[model samples]
Target: MCPVTVFEQDGCDLRVEWGLDGVHALGPHCAVLVVVDVLVFTTTVDVALGRGARVLPLPWRDERAAAMAEALGAVLTPPGLDESYGQPGWTLRPSSLTDLPAGTLLGIASPNGATLAAAAAETGTAVLAGCLRNASAVAAAASAIAEDRPVGVIAAGERWRPERTLRPSIEDYLGAGAIAAAVTGRSAPSSEATLAAVSYRAVRDRIPALLGGSISGRELIAAGVPEDVALATDVDVSTVVPVLDNGVFTS
Candidate 1:
């Protein structure tokens, strides 16, 4: 008989010893769960696709984003990089948030998304990347691979340097809840997640305020793209899931 184990935090089992260490420790047979909470990586993919701009992912900052874009005859812009982070090579573009050039590579730094993307680079399959903006689409893509297994949902938290009392944002949980409801056919595990999506469902106006507390939400606001987050939280906005292909973002 197979033994039973339980992880008390969410009433979940140990689930194969989570964390990047555990995932890499396994070496093989690790199903990757990518949760992109920054809202920039996933949302930009969705928005660009929606507006007919092709997108890619640059795992590092070494001219790759620009090099790939130039090779594809497109313009590149860095959304997550900041002056404090010592950005390189035209990291900020005035036209990025609105006018994304086709074949653009979005360089992201969310620890959660990066971790899952790395894991997906290993397995090639069973690596699901998702956000609340594309939650339903991600759920559908994941369901195709899930095929009777509990898929991982890595929550990409803040994009800043690690702090002592760091906390996960409501947006991540809200996105997780949406993905869970779509994939698990269950309600949100907490009021925050439930209200996040449900509130958007009930009133289309609260999304901006709800997202104002998110990691990217504040940055976006500071960058003068607050409306982007509001636009991102719109549920079922796209048909693309934006999976990680050998470290790049692809549908």
Candidate 2:
């Protein structure tokens, strides 16, 4: 379990940590859980939710996921970085999800963000998916749900090497920071949260360019999907907030 430092913010408590493991560690005290994956997953969720689609976040890629999707009458997304979801009403890229039919259901499998989201569902706290596009909305929704209860923001960082080790993702950090800052207002942020919030403020104006030049951004661009980067960096462009309940995300 990761060590959690509590912060008094907005006359309430708040906790921020990295990755799924951190979610497991601090989730119980977390009345509101915000999971951020700015590269694609959370961004896609934002877009899908904006279009009024119910998105089910599944952890890991396996044959079982297809069955779940079929049962939910939702389109299933493959767990690769490719731009396609191979379904009629779904796509992995956030920009593509904008045109989805309203009330559509989409089951998406992501290696990092979805995994943390799935795990966070078991904590009984309100679960929210956040990205650059909907950071303010997420913070508002989470704050409303949490009220005076503690809130936890989890940055679903990616692995660095072939082994499994959480490498701090700059985009996720900034996204989390933005949310944290928005949520806390003038509250005293913890050291880690402070760093993230400060980092986000520094590049608040250059979000699109910063994300485009990021490592994951470059990887996505190399994969022939630069539009995803643009969509993900459309800061505060969306007001729809996705809240997770019963294994699915809905606005």
Candidate 3:
């Protein structure tokens, strides 16, 4: 009865949904979108853009990845940090993008957020890469860009194991909530966005601890990327807002 995906067409002014399906259903409802992937992808984009680099987000890694980078004249993230291609100067990690020269176009690939970004463009809305680092700024920017257009905020959730179904990522939900709170302010938010905002406030005081112990956070720590988690949960530490334009994101 829900039409598989339904936009809760009622009160509030924003749509806060999750993953590709979220985009598919809610994208057209607004002309400005904020895509949040605090765990990594968008976080990397935020840092890169904060340093003045342009970013092109790719949905998934595949054969055309290298070709796309070359075509876009963007720097490719090395296949691995310790492998032969892991050049001393170039990287894909959010922490390492600071070394990239200003004015560079960085084409980044990720399994979730990046892909959702690409999909968001199809909605013909202005899309922005958002995270905890720039929540208030991104929300303010989105409010300005939206003007009269409705806004859609997509929390690009991580995959559930086994079937790899889209699972709500706590970090992403919190990130989305941060933006939602900023955007709504005294205004009422949709139920979804309200849920997100409440979730964020509940764990806001302990972001690092909450994320550090989350399933996704644990996986990143186990994989030796605790730094990424730290950088992402630093809350309001940045003002850079990565807005997607012409298939690229720039601050």
Candidate 4:
């Protein structure tokens, strides 16, 4: 009834939505989007820039991704970090809002969420990453940006799979609510965002259980990353905004 449209597609509905094929066909067309890969998105961005690497985002066949980065003076790297670190060329890195301050521009190379960020960046609007960790801060920043300019929020999900069914990232969705709360100044989020927020909030005590259920969580524990998830789950530490520039991710 709000006249706003929300698109939902997955698994059994993949065929109806055209699944992976649909993303390639429809993803590029979005004017603005904020791909919120929350857990890894902001964390990876923070780590890459904190390490002092120039990050450039390359999205498979999306020519515009590289073109935009190049246009902004960013260097191109191998498809993924594996190939990039094996060679040389500024050593492309990853970044997010938590790594830089407001007003700094960055060219991102997200292995998984490049298309969403690319679409948003294409619109001449300020593109900022959002996460539950920085949800309120990001929303405030986005609201300020939107007051005088257009802004879009994109939730970066796992890899696009046509035939395979994937569940939406609960963390990212909760982060989105935080963003919406900041943007709209409403006591509650839109129905969809509210559900996401409630879901994640409800699982507060079950983080360990939830982690055990996740592929990445199991991998991290198995690899003995030592507090990797705990570090990622830190609710508040610094309110830095990571920005990408010339293939470098800086705060």
TM-score of each: 0.65, 0.89, 0.89, 0.60
User: How good is model 2 by TM-score?
Assistant: 0.89
By summed lDDT, the worst window of 10 consecutive residues in model 3 runs over 79-88
Estimate the overall C-alpha local distance difference test score of candidate 3: 0.80
Instruction: List candidate 2 segments past 4 Å from native.
Output: 1-12, 82-89, 185-188
Q: Which residue pairs collide, candidate 1? A: none
Which of the two, 1 or 2, has more TM-score?
2
lDDT of 1 by residue, 59-166 (tens): 434445456556655445543445313344423322244565555554443334444455546744455556666888887776666555444454445433554123
lDDT of 1: 0.51
The 0-to-1 C-alpha lDDT of every candidate, in the order given, reads 0.51, 0.81, 0.80, 0.45
Tell me which residue pairs clash in candidate 2: none
Candidate 4's C-alpha runs over 4 A off are 1-33, 49-54, 61-108, 148-152, 160-167, 181-184, 187-189, 204-209, 223-228, 243-251
Task: Give lDDT tens digits, candidate 4, residues 1-251.
Answer: 11222442211101111223323332333222334665454555554544453344455466676677767665444554334333533332232222443333345454544444444444443455555555566666555544533234555555434543444554555445445544643332334445545555666556545654566555445644425555455553446454433323355
Alpha-carbon lDDT of model 4: 0.45
- How does residue 232 of candidate 4 score in lDDT? 51
The best-first sequence of candidates by lDDT reads 2, 3, 1, 4
